[model samples]
Target: MKPRTLVIGDIHGGLKALKQVLARAEVTAQDTLIFLGDYVDGWGESAQVIQFLIELEQKQTCIFIKGNHDLWCEDWLKEHILDKTWLFHGGQSTLKSYESLNDAEHALHLNFFERMRLYYVDEQNRLFVHAGFTSMHGPAQEFHQSNFKWDRTLWEMALTMHKHITKDSKLYPKRLLLFKEIFIGHTPTLNYDVTIPMNGCNVWNVDTGAAFTGSLTIMDIDTKEFWQSDTLVSLYPNEKGRNR
Candidate 1:
């Protein structure tokens, strides 16, 4: 049997938490790991988390989706100047992570960033994006690239729906109907007072708030079986994550 596809949420540089979730998920060489982005910022090991992910690719199939923060990091890498807004939102930690890397390592990490996708849709029509998708006209590619990593309307609309029905349902975003399932991780589930993966209108939000007080989540796309780490702060006991 083929290994399952595990879609993970925002990590925010919580290396320990990332490791814990992966171990709990029982990921194997046959498994496909799809990271929903925000791999850096917030915690002390942002740099290490990226390096760990790079190494993991050598053994497992890993798909990375670019997030808003990841885009900020890209800008910083090219300009070598920190944007104030980015700095305000835990960007300092990402910079700190890169400061420890040597020249060659920096290039490799940059390559990883450059290779990130705005969104990934598998053969099964399972859509994976860092944030929510916008527009009711067509598929993810029809919208702007930023929409893939920054829009929250998809999840927000799902939240307002009374149930999770898919066929002929007017309560949810019509664009979502294009896929069998849509997986995203930008809007943390913690805001809903939940720390685990959540489902609304056939959309699954796996970001259990690893950047805040919640844990990180990794869910099997088909079975919906999932795993979560302890509160992110617990993973990095010594550091205050984004002071959140």
Candidate 2:
């Protein structure tokens, strides 16, 4: 089989959904998996998700990009301090998930989080980031690193200019011109009433809202082919899963 480069969206601790999507995608060790982060904080298996990914990395080529939720989890792992805002947004579930992990396992997961990249630009000039960057020059030139994990302006601009403006037009966004394509996952497509990956201009958003009531997605970057799991609410029926 030919090697493939697959981009995955946010897991939000839905380990079952993540597993289902990977199986549906028929992912192989020969493929390179680029995960868009948010591995924790939503469902009840954040720790399990991290552990699974850690094991998955041993056999498959994987690129992990850090997301905003992952950053908050990392901070708590390192400092033992919980942010009220984080708790309100789903950190409580993550905290409960970690209760089953030993100190050694926690240390391993922390190391995994610390090693994640803010953004990655491929040799083909395709950018894979957990979220969007603000720099017109590219993510490397970004002034505020946090934007790499939290900015929505880039995606918004792409949507607004999608088919309205041509690349040659003076009104075209300089930031959009920097990459051949961009893949991201901070924002969910369900917000716009979509369950599949959403495309705007050269940007593709793969987050289909697995944290709440949607599914987890994995896409083949070259073919734009994608696979998704069943709705998270159905997978974990008893849990609210960040729906609150």
Candidate 3:
């Protein structure tokens, strides 16, 4: 019975911030880490973030779910979406993530990313979705394959279907809500606090929009304890050299 349920919010490529937060969180071998998606885009170190995640998965019980950003990445790679948008949204960082890898290694990562699940569930707790789903489907995990995978509409609909309670807040709070606490990202917080009020329901917005700021946050699901880091990092060699 591990006491800590470390759930990381949307990273958005800020590897240095994420690293500092992880260190402050003091992850241990006994601790299980659940990653909410959107690990790429909008930061300087998308490649490092992905590679770190891959390594962590090998060493620990890391459960991850997909975000819309991830889907878009796949779509772009598959020619379903424009690559320029991906590049513009820090996709270059992701591309650079494979700079040291050979062709085979890059392809392996591509395959791994492609096979990522949209959401995950346990008998006691569900995990690691970049955004949540709402549907007539009985359980949260019971969403249809296509509906669950790339359908933001399905997730939004499920929130309404749950009939969760909500209210208008200072930050555009007219949205609907949900019953279950779906760990999510995508929508950013105004102050970059790593918390967003999407529908004011059980859903928790964890992206914190680090691409615009330096704070990357993680919440302990079991205890609702939150942690963050604001370390700065530069991506380009020139930037690094100048800072040094």
Candidate 4:
């Protein structure tokens, strides 16, 4: 029997790079294509990025987790976030992707970004998250909106102080938070290789910062193989400090 596996990680709104990574994975019906999120707000083609995932959703088992960037897209559509700020941060190209749409059509475009999940996991020995968990076996509840979605302070604390637990976190406090590898995005790798803790919570980060100088990457879970696409030229540089 062919081994079943899952491929996932951050896309950061680059449709072309996403496609190339899928091609490299040689995705098959037996395999699942999962995304860790950040569906919009970087590179060109937010509409195209959403459309691509939507189409893929039809033929394969896909799970789209929401990321901070995605939340910004939803906020932008609702005008909850200022357009100039949104567009300034790699969102201009995303806006351009839907420039031709009428109001009704635009609402449809808006819907995609609005509906997304925050986390996903299973007994299959895998879990996925946009950033990282709260603390050493920190409650998954810490990832709840009240924790990171709406509270910047908590989010920053998690980011600045959190460490990938090698053994257990509150989220998996009792079960040992097991994973031969936990694949993730949100944090750009120092170079190109995925960072894994020497003892536990081995991480495979495929987000090669495709929205900037990084390559779009995806990994084959069962084979320990990875596929990457070259950097798409940055349309919005100096979005600075904030992650894509």
What local lDDT does model 4 show for residue 191?
42
For TM-score, the strongest prediction is: 2
What RMSD, rounded to one decimal, does every model reach? 1.7, 0.7, 6.3, 5.3
Q: What is the C-alpha lDDT profile of model 1 across 1-244, one tens digit per residue?
A: 5679899899999999999988887788999999999998899888899899999999989999999998898787766768898898899988888887898988888889999998888998888988876667644445577888788888887777737554675654677678888899999888889978888877899999999899998898989989899998887888878755
lDDT of each: 0.86, 0.94, 0.60, 0.60
Residue 226, model 1: lDDT of 91
Error of 1 at 146 (Å): 1.1
Give the lDDT ranking, best first.
2, 1, 3, 4
TM-score of each: 0.94, 0.99, 0.72, 0.74
How high is the lDDT of residue 233 in model 1? 82
lDDT of 2 by residue, 1-244 (tens): 7999999999999999999998999989999999998999999999999999999999989999999999999999999879998998899999999998899999999999999999998999999998898877788889999999999999999999998989999989999999999999989999999999999999999999999889999999999999999999999999999964
Regions of model 4 farther than 4 Å from truth: 1-3, 83-85, 135-139, 143-181, 190-200, 234-244
Off by over 4 Å in 1: 139-141, 164-166, 169-172
Candidate 4 lDDT tens digits, 1-244:
3635655555666677777767776777667777877777666567778877877777877877777777767777777475676667667766677777678766775776666766667566666666656434542646455232222232233333336442444543332344444556666563435332111224455555665566676776667667776555543343331243
Q: How many residue pairs clash in each candidate?
A: 0, 0, 5, 7
Ordered list by TM-score, greatest first: 2, 1, 4, 3
As for candidate 1, its clashing pairs are: none
The predicted structure with the larger lDDT, 3 or 4, is 3
